[model samples]
Target chain A: MSKIAVIGLGSMGYGMAQSCLRAGHDTWGVDINADAMARFAAEGGRAGALPADLDIAMIVVLNAAQTEAVLFGETGIVADLPKGAVVIACATVPPEFALKMQERCAKAGVLYLDAPISGGSVKAANGQLSIMASGSAQAFAAARPALDATAETVFELGDSAGAGSAMKAVNQLLAGVHIATMAEALTFGMTQGVTPDKFVEVISKCAGSSWMLENRAPHIVDGDYTPRSSVNIWPKDLGIVLDIAKSAQFSAPITAVALQQFVAAAGMGFGGEDDAAVAKVYARNAGLTLPGEDA
Target chain B: MSKIAVIGLGSMGYGMAQSCLRAGHDTWGVDINADAMARFAAEGGRAGALPADLDIAMIVVLNAAQTEAVLFGETGIVADLPKGAVVIACATVPPEFALKMQERCAKAGVLYLDAPISGGSVKAANGQLSIMASGSAQAFAAARPALDATAETVFELGDSAGAGSAMKAVNQLLAGVHIATMAEALTFGMTQGVTPDKFVEVISKCAGSSWMLENRAPHIVDGDYTPRSSVNIWPKDLGIVLDIAKSAQFSAPITAVALQQFVAAAGMGFGGEDDAAVAKVYARNAGLTLPGEDA
Candidate 1:
């Protein structure tokens, strides 16, 4: 079994850390939150200090800034890793930032795998996350054990760092826009007297349906805004997408408009609520009450 | 056999007319185009003047204006129909317009079924179209025979005229946005080196997918924009959506953005091309050549 360190014991990272432990890896869970680290330790995970012969450092942090800090900051773990060790970056970061990280890792005689994950926290715990991965063959070979334990599908996008992150940005573009569009359609239906329940019932079977719609619309139907994925995610994720598009001179007008809706939702203090709560922005604008709202 | 007249024998109407004929209705196909009329006549459809004893006048025209023209304009058929005969209006119209037509038809002692259809022309021919219907019980009873002939599922929305049209508007809002978002995502993937074929294979199975993505991405992969549903349909359909949204004072920013993409596609002279050709707008904007284009 490989010695694996999973930094950032948030929803996705904690599940991934558990998956590694379940797969018989000598797994370590690291987080700023002491309670999360203690919880992982209770669940047969190593909690304190880095192992000298770490095989894989799976960074499942939030974004580029956090990922960079966890990797190369003053008290970073990259300096603590042995030669030939792989750093599996599982953050949704810009492709250019991923490339730069790979270069820095190379200079330090460390392998870097650009691995942005999908399928959310539940899938991560079940070891069924989809990992969009790219790096050198050596990095792939080094990261294989951790990947096998954590991912159901690993899309080997290219023999480099940037491609996987690029694909992830593309996915975020679609996924973010789809959630907002679902909100727009559902609330627009409300204005026309189609209830949230009926909107979910009919549209889920129709060509109007998306993976985001089918998955998220039911949350609106149930009037549960508990953040499976929060409204705050879109501004960050779609912000990365639009930034990438801007760098490439790509005109993503739909993505732009969708980003605005998420921003509106965030501005309305629904940022921490479920992304389905974007429908509240529409409901408020049209003066219609959603399923569980007071009129 | 019920005596039925299907006006505007275009792709959807012609197939619906054929479905009626197949169901053993004495169906009369009417169109301004002589070729369409001749074709339907060869397919066992009556190509002639309206039968005065018409039990069902199914107006499968384009929009609100055309539907109004066919039912109440110069040389209208509503005055020609027998009293108690039903006018099964199968066009995507404003709910208000539908209620207006229903009220007007009531004055002429005719029942009106506000029926807006879904599923494409293929489903239309196979008599498996989904009909969103609402009207009085008398109208439902009168239109039942024609509905059974042409629709696999008839959603009886309400005991009035507006609900069916309202649902149709909701469906169109989601459908239109999903299509444009698919193009946006696919083209964005192209900018990231994900080929059109790989996109269909991967994204179709991912949370990024929509029903439109799975259905229309193949047309792009094959480089065939053969107008299964033309780009021209969106400006009309989404225009109707925005109109309805405006009436309710609903802000549909995502739908508004998607509508602009289709309008751009139409302005790019791909109005007659498959709605999938909205990808062309993204491709052009990004300087990316899609598969089957001379790069």
Candidate 2:
């Protein structure tokens, strides 16, 4: 069993930490939230400070800034990490940022793997997430135990850092836009006479259906905006997409409009609700009532 | 066997006519294109004018105007159609227009089944199309032979004309946005080194995928613009969606943007190409060369 530290014990991170611990790794879970750390300890995660000879540091933080803070900021673990230890970065960040982190880690004789994850919290806890990963062979070897623990499918994208993050951005672009479009069409159907249940029943079998639509539309049908994935995710994820598109001079008009809808959803204070709650913006705009709403 | 007339022998119409003939119906195929009609005749379709005692007049025309023109224009078929014969309207039109046509057809003692078809030309030819239908019980009974011959799945939406058309518009809204978004994400991926081939390989297995993406991305990977479903269909279909949304006071911003991308593709002179050619818009904007293009 490898020695591993999984920083940021949020939903995904906590589940990943659990997967590592379940796989018989000596795993430490770190988070600013003490309760999260305590809960992980209660679930058989290693207690106390991270060991110096850690084999893998899996950072499942939110964004680039937080990822950097955890790796290289004051009280950062990169300097504390033993040489040859792999830092498996799992956050969705720009490709350039991943490359930069890889370069800085390499200068300190540390291996870095750009590994952005797919599938959600449940998948993470089940050790069935898909990981899009790229780095040196040594990085891959050092990170293998944790990767084996947490991921069901590991797409070896390239022999470098940027490719995994690039693919993740591409995925986030499609995923975020799909969620918003599902909301747009479902609510638009409501403006006609198609009920939310009927929309789910019929469209899921039709060509219009997406993975996100099939996964999230039932939440709207049940009127449960319990935030499996929140509306706040789009503005951040699509922001990365548009930023990347701008640098490449690519025109992503559909993604642009999809981002605006999510922004509107956030502005309407549904940011913390389920991403399907984006339908509420359309429902409100058209003066229609969603399922489970006050009529 | 029922006496049937299948009008508008285009790709979808001609295939539908073949399906009717295959089902042992005494079917007549009519089209402005003589070669199409001649081809249908060679395939066992009956020749000459539609019979006066026809049990079904299935108008598989392009849009609402053509549907209206075929039914009530100069030399209109409704005047020639026998009483109680069903008119299976298979084009995408506004729900309001479907209701209006139902009213007009009812005055002539004729039945109208608002049956907007899905599945493309291949399924049309194979008699495996999905038909979203709504009409009176008598209308459905009259149209049953043709529907049975042509549709693999028939969604009986409601007891009237508007519901089928409304559901179709919703499907079109999502389908159209999905096609454009696939192009958007695919080319956007290209800008970041995610090749079209790798894109289809990976995203099809991920949550980012849609039915349209799985169906259309291959055309991009092969760089084939063969018109399985041409780019021209979107402007007309999404135009109907935005028009209906406007009437409903529904703000469909994502659909509006998707419409613009299709418009741009048409403006770029890809109207005759497959719908996947929408990727060319993003490819051109980003200075990327798609497969099989002169780089």
Candidate 3:
């Protein structure tokens, strides 16, 4: 019923494009990678330049820079979008950046929604992601079709741009730190002869566990570092958090320490592996063999 | 109906003593503070010095030092306990320290059960605590009555002294880090204009959440600092974690960073306040007012 374009056809974007198509929307998928574009086209997504009469432009790029490049860069889409159309930005950018983007979009007669998403790749493919969204009422009305197609939960955070991104930063702060800390505790337990399997078995029921612990510990238990969310994500996400903390003069020591661990994991060449592979850093440091790492 | 003595009639110990009495045991409550002992006595607990013929002695003291003083120091009770009796040590102590106590008790022909408890003061009162316990088969057999009386979940970790304490350390490592991290995330949310109430509501449903967040965030939302668990407990517990990590040559930066926040909270004279009051340190740094604090 709606004409939609999903920019930056990464793991999340490609799935979101599929969800739009599944909902019977006229969907266009755009990516720098030719393979991704070809794959989306093979999956029945439209492959041409987005039609100017698009109802929604879902930006699922990596960061503010990529988001801006897509919306306001050379061959910018927002200026090309018809009046009253909505641009849903799904990058984990700062609240200030989101607000600024909203202001710029408003000046161009384009509605912008701060709509950073969660629930990861699998959920994205299943049309079951959670969206933290805040924008004008008109923007919400315009973006409804895409939202209804993609999200299982939509937290309407506020009536403006900054609040949704603010909440996203808060979630990222906790998520990144928890993932690294799970690695720390799992590996620390290993030193005491608590195997990864036992760590998952017992701690999951104890007061010590977190959502990240229950979700990611199995990766270490199986020695599977396939990047559900890669080691590279923490540096970028926690960096956004630290930057926001710096701007707010907030001291987040635990977040800082967690950032260092992720950086260390990346430094050790595990950047492309699953974020749970942060445990491999601890495993190596303590000379312990993680599951599947035994020689 | 086993004859048992519970040392240290503090909040946790008193509840444990009541649980023992409720289980039809002849439970003796002892404390340096006569008021605590008298209070438990008024609640149907036996009031007297521990009888030497005590079949089991449960030491529910505060720390490694207190556990040591109560068991082996001047007027040490381990020597006074009857031969073949069991001592269920319910203090959070280093695995090495638990092993040492087990050895000392063995020399006196006594059984020692390394039994560190969880579930806090409320669970203790309800006889629903989780006990992480290890020792010989005889020690488990002898302490079975007390375990049944006081614990709803008893983790029989191993038939040795160190494993129980080691498991407790692992739990504490996860737990202490979690509490501090919850405070960190909640306060970070505040800096982003996310109210304490909203932070609790939203994060509790997200992957960012932990058991500690659900348990402690309400105290912040209500602005109450009643000492469910004191800020001082973290420095002590996380210090034990850091010490163990050091011994294992395991680097625990996140735990180390979290420990510093609690140390700061303690240094700011909030050592007596509830552990949730660590948010005060964040609030002060960011010039944000928490729900219960004076702006």
Each model's chain A TM-score: 0.98, 0.98, 0.99
Across B181-224, the per-residue lDDT of candidate 2 in tens digits comes to: 99999999998889999999999999999999999999999989
* Tens-place lDDT digits, model 2, residues A172-239: 99999999999999999988899999999999999999999999999999999988778998899999
| Highest TM-score model number | 2
Q: What is the TM-score of chain A in candidate 3?
A: 0.99
Candidate 3 residues lying further than 4 Å off, grouped into runs, are none
Docking class of 1: high
Candidate 3 lDDT, tens digit per residue, A1-295?
9999999899899889999999999999999999999999999998998887889999999999999999999988988999999999999999999999999999999999999999898888889999999999999999999999999999999999999999999999988988988899989888887778878887888888899999999999998999888999899999999999999999898999899889999999999999999998888898889889865
Query: What shift in Å separates residue A76 of candidate 1 from its native position after superposition?
Result: 2.0
Query: Each candidate's fnat, in order?
Result: 0.80, 0.88, 0.78
| TM-score of candidate 3 relative to the true fold | 0.98
Worst 10 residues of 2 chain A by lDDT: A225-234
Count of clashing pairs, candidate 3 = 0
Better model by TM-score: candidate 1 vs candidate 2: 2
Instruction: Report model 1's TM-score to 2 decimal places.
Output: 0.97
Per-candidate local distance difference test: 0.92, 0.94, 0.91
> By the lDDT metric, which is better: model 2 or model 3?
2
Better of 1 and 2 by lDDT: 2
